[model samples]
Target: MGKPAKNKEVKPKRNRITFETKAKIIKLKDEGKRNSELAKMFGYSTSTIATIYNAKSKAIVQRAVEECVPQGVCVFKTEYRPTVLNDLDTILYEWFKRNEGRKVALTMTALQCKARSIFAILMDPAHGIF
Candidate 1:
């Protein structure tokens, strides 16, 4: 196989249970859907359904689904974001939480800018960011 590009994020596996999918699975479970049913519906495994569903999972799922879980993603990730880009996850989530319930429209460019700012703030040696 050819070497993967250094700059490109690896695409998620076709069946990887993303946070948005987790939210749906959790909702289905709450609505009395069975694990087998969910596994069949989402084309993932039962264990994946079970693992991402739990009492404590609501909080993380909440972060992941903050803004309706856009088609291109917009939040925290356990199984969603690439590990290398998640060094500032906490900061990013905090920003999301801070802006929760507000009608702040986030364009792709805005999100990219935010990510860059967060990266700069976190990686800045002086830590004196404005």
Candidate 2:
């Protein structure tokens, strides 16, 4: 006899609004369009339109769009990460740009290896990898 199958929990899909749409919503609102009107036009609820229209920082929203960041990510959170490798990041960025300029493409594995080697070299001599 087989045991009963466990019910799987399904996560709801997130509906991400693009930056352009958000900007349009704000522009329309500034032009005296009501939340309900904007909602109907954009196919979202009134609250959703109102939230974007009334966001604290419009610049953050615009910047996120220009950078291709998802809508739900906070701008401040994206600005900095406490655990970032500053020196390694600078090295990687320059390496990537140089490769791109030379028309040399690197695969994910190659990039990973490069990153690991750089990280190893930057590590303190007292705490060398075994």
Candidate 3:
């Protein structure tokens, strides 16, 4: 007996849109052709043709619209703002001047202590915190 017939069948491949088709779509859109007609001419769906038309139609108009507007002119204030460092500069200067020992340096532990002290001073409203 002959072998059982195969159940699977090969499906035809979908066609890719070429550059010529894209150019034709753009040309037709620029010429004000209807999206439905363009779809028929290019063997594409109406929605696909509409998308292409909309994208192409917006390209130049978008660029023109973006170009016509001038960017806003910003004025920056260069005044120096007092900060926590400014508040502590006097106290820190006095501390450094009194502890002028050659071994004095900003080690990690000293940095942490300084940071905590600064935080405390900043939190104290009567200390003229920034």
Candidate 4:
């Protein structure tokens, strides 16, 4: 007897938007665009756009973007997780973007290996980040 195959669908991975994007959203909204239009443009749900638009810290986000730009830094999140290494996150994200832009296929094992290598190099005594 043959086993039946399980029917399941896989969804694309979702990425978190950056503070610069949030600032742009706020600016566009101030220019008279509606939430639905922004949502469609940003590939998010209308509710999400509305949430960003209605969030009380809109000015704060704008300020963060302006302040971080000249300093060559970014506000990745409202709260930082102690275990996360910011440099690792930035490097990994840039790596992902570069490869993805070239249409390269990335898998979990490849990503894990890359992260291990990056962490090793970054933690080395010779690395300037130290």
TM-score of each: 0.37, 0.40, 0.32, 0.47
Model 2 Cα lDDT, one tens digit per residue, 1-130: 9999999999767676866788788888998999998888889989888789778276465665547754333446655332226667888889988998998878999889988887777664644367
Worst 10 residues of 2 by lDDT: 75-84
Task: Report lDDT (CA) for all predictions.
Answer: 0.69, 0.74, 0.64, 0.76
Q: TM-score: which is higher, 1 or 4? A: 4
The candidate scoring highest on TM-score is 4
Q: List the residue pairs that clash in candidate 2.
A: none
- Cα lDDT over the full model 3: 0.64
> What is the C-alpha lDDT profile of model 1 across 1-130, one tens digit per residue?
9988689788766654456677788889989999899999988788877877764366475664655654334355554563335667777777776666586876778777888898777655666555
* lDDT of prediction 4: 0.76
**Which regions of candidate 3 fall more than 4 Å away from where they truly are?**
1-12, 57-130
Model 4 residue 57 distance off true place after TM-score fit, in angstroms: 0.4
Ranking by TM-score: 4, 2, 1, 3
Reference-based TM-score, model 3: 0.32
Q: Which ten residues in a row have the lowest lDDT in candidate 1?
A: 70-79
Better of 1 and 2 by lDDT: 2
Residue pairs in clash, model 3? none
Clashing pairs in 1: none
lDDT of 2 at 49: 85
Highest lDDT: which candidate?
4
